[model samples]
Target: MGSRDLHQGATMTAMSGATIHQVAKAAGVSPSTVSNFLNGRPGRMLPETRARVEEAIRHLGYRPNRAARQLRTGRVQVVGLVVPSVANPFWGAFALHLEGAALAAGYHVLLCNSARDPERERAYIDELWADGIRGVVLCSSLPSLDHVLPLVEQGLNLVAFDRTAQAGDPSRMVNISVDNVIGAQLATRHLLELGHRRIAFVSGALRSVNRRERFRGFRDALENAGLSPDDAIVWSGAADEPYGDLDVAGLGRRAAADLMRGDDPPTAIVAINDMCALGVSAGVRDAGLRVGQDVSVVGFDDIVLADLAAPPLTTVRQPMADMAAAAFTHLRECVESDEPATGRSLLMRPELVVRGSTGPVPPPR
Candidate 1:
């Protein structure tokens, strides 16, 4: 039959509830062949047969009954992905890459935004576990993993992203992240090399593991330069706020304005991320100061917009695609393996990308 005729047939069959047997008959193949296609075991099947089955499925809009499949196989073809906030483009980009990897492996991603709240993270994970999702990629980077320890102990295949493995973490847990400390150090050292002595570190909160590490790296860089770490300015007015993710850019802008108003304003600012860096750049203009000339600004996470900024931000680059692929690969291995889970941490290196937003310490203003 022609494609249109097959689609019409499928519509009628779907209205009456299509089944594997019906699909097999429509494809002129045995039900076992259809089963093999659904189960991802069609490698041995002839190319034409596989194509026929795929076409039949597409024309029929056939969706496998996941409930029945799970009942029989005790597994679901879906994985959970929990991110801090999609407001930050960094997290959104990471999610896109991660989803791409998941789709290629024949799995779907269920994304949740937790706003860096531990309780919310635990609740979402609980829901995912209850829904038969055995694997998850959590990107909250919370300082402690205690909230979800119970679920992890119960055999949830979890891959923590943007957070380093801690001593108290479960033995089987997988942690994947760019080396935040080194990344921050690279950003700060670049500023120091430009002869910027009065530097400031700007971020929302020093609560999360990654943020804390970045702060430490900033301090380490300052100390390495023979400058007292305490001499560097640190702005985190929103430290007590729970919804900092929603207004990261605003926070950076505010920090910039307040710092520039001071008598000993910093010659350079190291923002938490590119979003905040963009905000800082705006704030610099608000204070009637040129970004690259008056006060250099450096940001972490070389997001797409970093290059599009008015002055083109100089920032640290995370290998987002590679990290996403690694996270998915590790999670899938844990999900499909029959062996006992073993804990592992993957720390990817980051590179510094210089752009127009930073420059030599503006000849002491």
Candidate 2:
């Protein structure tokens, strides 16, 4: 049978009172054309045929069922977004931008929290797929991405953010991130320029690509200046802990306290993120030391509360909106394309925002 004849035969019986086939038969066109027209799919149809389909739909009072359409297509008009923690200020800001961008593009975003757990991330991925989510933007920082890659290979469009390089196959996934190394260098450079030689680095997880890159930047700046940055490093011991399970602020506070216990405490501190920096600042005050004057503190991410802290925060600012826009655009391209996006890594620049938290090193007693 001819293509049109086949469509007519397959759609002959009306599953619904006003089925797509009836409209196609009335309009003297194929059922696929009618389906396309009703679904707002863009295509060139003869003016008379278009008019006929419209009139037939009106005459038959046909209403397309979105649920049935989704089932037929095996997809939904939405995408999934997985983040380490929705409660983290940085992730929260990112989620808002992502949701806004998705909405602007006529798509909905289903936000899921991985809590930095592999199992939870795995489950969420499966659940999202079962819900007909064809695309996902993942911002996980776990040590392994074993669970995620298999799904992508199964035809899921994935955009990796924050810790993109860890996904193993950049060829099959869209990767987007800020130059965390530059951000850390900026923070460390600011402290060094302030004549703070004995600076302390407080960090949470090293497994996260962002954290590792930031640390590398920190070392690069110090080594470039002929200083030993390794002597200043202090792990927060939260590397293996899931997000929200360990209080990063408390980790900062404890790290600051431990550093102060030394006979020669650091003249300045650099925190992995703004939340930890705030904790470090509080720790300094609790130890009868001034922020800025006694010991300067610098942070990364420049979150909203960074400025509202006691001394405010001198930090590196990630371009959340720009990154979100780029990631959304990439994912949408992958979703719409017949070929997958490959081997492209977009690294955005971060700026240094000097606030009240950093200053010249204090005079020794």
Candidate 3:
């Protein structure tokens, strides 16, 4: 029922399979007018004409063929964003913020969940490119962006958050992110101040740059404190472990329980994200140990779930709202203007929020 599908024969009436022409003829307007009305464009049409088109389409139950209209306009007024794991609160919350900003900027967002699967991510990228979207945002990315580099190089208006193709590759991508290094350092130092000498850094996986950066911050903090940085205490080994990243939050929930139950475990743990902290908290409870009371824990990306846990989790708050706003701003600049954002590298600092999860370390158990 749109530009390309103006003819009654090319469209369908979901319920009765009627065409646009059928609806238009019954409504007393040409197929083109009916198509425009259904496509949400009524700028020049007369008030009476617009009403007639609407009534006819309604009476005949004509539904516009979005696929057909998308061809004529060369745009769907919709932007697409591909991110890893919506089940993770960080990406999930970012999705909401992005959709909000898009709508305020007179565009709609089409969300795609890659579930951290590389193949699925590549497929979504190709699909969005084919869909004629105005702009794109990639949250989780690969180590090599050579494949998609051409698109951005050709001025495709792409903004990336979280991760990008490779280090030092800003030729085609506008990168924006929270200062994960600072946040991680804050968490690590907090544990150190609490007198926990043997602190473990936990992550679901180390494949992501965010996690890697957090580890970097953790190491930096140790070195700053004149303490030897120990990689053996880092849980990046979870990369090969099934559901490693997903278990971070779950680990936070039971930290004390598991540690107390075990004969050997760190007195304090720093989770990659708040979700991982929850899992740690769970281990605390399962072992009947008190977090902050016996074992302290900290997490990153202070999501709402972090505050909702039994003892609101102590975490490093990544300014997700500001990060999302920056993504859209950079993309809009890239799209509406010819030049790139003259200044790149927007880094929002992470704030450490202490709650029930962290506390002074208890003597060795």
What are the C-alpha RMSDs, in order, of all predicted structures?
Answer: 3.4, 6.8, 5.6
Q: TM-score of model 3 relative to the true fold?
A: 0.77
lDDT, candidate 2, equals: 0.81
lDDT of each: 0.88, 0.81, 0.73
Model 1, residue 88: what's the lDDT? Answer: 83
| Model 3 C-alpha lDDT versus the unseen true structure | 0.73
Cα lDDT tens digits for candidate 3, 1-365: 23443456444443445677887788788888777776558876999888887787666556655666678766566778887667788888999999888889977888887655666766776777777765788876445555566566666667768752355575656767778788889999898898878788776567767668888899899888888876327665433553344445554444434445555677888887777777877776677777777778888888998889877899998888888988887787666565676336677778999898888878765
Error of 2 at 334 (Å): 0.5
**Stretches of candidate 3 exceeding 4 Å from the true structure:** 1-69, 164-170, 237-239, 242-247, 250-264
Tens-place lDDT digits, model 2, residues 116-222:
77888889999998888888888875546688778887888887787646545635876788898888998999998999899888887676677788888988888
**lDDT tens per residue, model 1, 1-365:** 13344454455666756678878988999988999998768896999999999988887667777788888887887889999888689999998998899999988999899998999999999999998888999998987899999998999988889999888888768889999999999999999999999999998877788888888899999999999977889997564666468888888899999999999999999998898899889999999999998999999999999999989999999999999999888888878884435878899999999999999887655
Write out the backbone clash pairs for model 2: none
Ranking by lDDT: 1, 2, 3
Candidate 1 clash pair list: none
Residue 79 displacement (Å), model 2: 1.5
